[model samples]
Target: MDVFDHDAGGISGRRPLVEIEEGAGFPDGLTVDAEGCVWVALWDGGAVRRYTPAGELDRVVTLPTPRTTACAFGGPGLTDLYVTTARTGLASPHPLSGSLLVVPGAGKGLPQPAFEG
Candidate 1:
């Protein structure tokens, strides 16, 4: 498994092929675009950050709730993004977690091939 430092605080030291930028947050889910941009969903931070292929900060998208679980590219043209969020904490007041979200995405998504065996 490959590991990248994305703490974004003052944590120093180089590890492997990945390096985190300054002031970034904890990342939970991640997806790569056709242009090689990385979109990371912050677990507790309640937002997503887009990074360039070279590790530069590009853009950020905010979410309505906290605890984004995962993300992926879907649809026929792959121009749509699907985000999954979790509502881990609750006493049964309202339907919170385990919800699906769809949003507009940039560029085209390649078809995912089925793994053989």
Candidate 2:
């Protein structure tokens, strides 16, 4: 993803943060950890990848099914990775397709901000 300069409506200073190969599936859902690292789900790649703030590949977590759609942190400590999958458009879906797969001890999530409006 590209990081845009946070000035003038973020219309300038666009820079590449990371690049994923076309053959390595598309980058789908993404979230930032409390430590400022990025967690990205690879759609049709059957895996999740973590990258450091400096755009370095830090970790990879493979799933039983492809079509990984989205991810988020949950559980008591916010360290559990809740991954959502999709079975749409598949002739024969995997057993775990369209399931909420949770990976324990994935990472800590940012504290949720309150909004009342």
Candidate 3:
């Protein structure tokens, strides 16, 4: 996966600031924290990885299910990390597969901005 920097003109010309190898499992979804760290959900890897703004791996949180799909921060002060998983391809589903997990005190996250159309 790659994160890019757009030029002043537009997205027509841009360069990727971070390029992660495909061997690192598919990145399904991600969210940026208040500290500018990125939390990424790994599908088929059963884990979520936190990456620093410099593209360095900071931390990893593993889940019981391999099909972890998405994640977000919620609850009071956005100090909780909520993860979502899937059981679509599991031969023997894990007890928590396809469930919503609330991990308290994961880290502080920035509140999502409301769309202004």
Root-mean-square deviation (CA) per prediction: 7.1, 1.7, 2.3
Give the per-residue lDDT digits (tens) of candidate 3, residues 36-114. 9899899888898899988888998988888878989999999999999999978999999999988899999888878
Relative to the unseen true structure, what is the C-alpha lDDT of residue 78 in candidate 3, on a scale of 0 to 100? 98
Q: Write the per-residue lDDT of candidate 2 for residues 1-117, one digit (tens) a residue.
A: 777668656577789989997877789998899999889999999989999989999999999888998888989989999999999888889999999999999999876777977
Error of 1 at 15 (Å): 4.7
In terms of lDDT, model 2 sits at 0.89
Q: Would you estimate the TM-scores of all the predictions?
A: 0.69, 0.90, 0.85
**Per-residue lDDT over 35-107 for candidate 1, one digit per residue giving the tens place of the 0 to 100 score:** 8777777776556667777777787777765777777889878998777887777454225456777778644
Alpha-carbon lDDT, every model = 0.68, 0.89, 0.86
Error of 3 at 19 (Å): 5.3
Which regions of candidate 3 deviate over 4 angstroms? Answer: 7-9, 12-24, 115-117
Ranking the candidates on lDDT from highest down gives 2, 3, 1
TM-score-wise, the better of 1 and 2 is 2
Residue 77 lDDT (model 3): 99
Candidate 2, residue 1: lDDT: 78
Off by over 4 Å in 2: 7-11, 115-117
**Candidate 2 residue-wise lDDT at 83:** 93
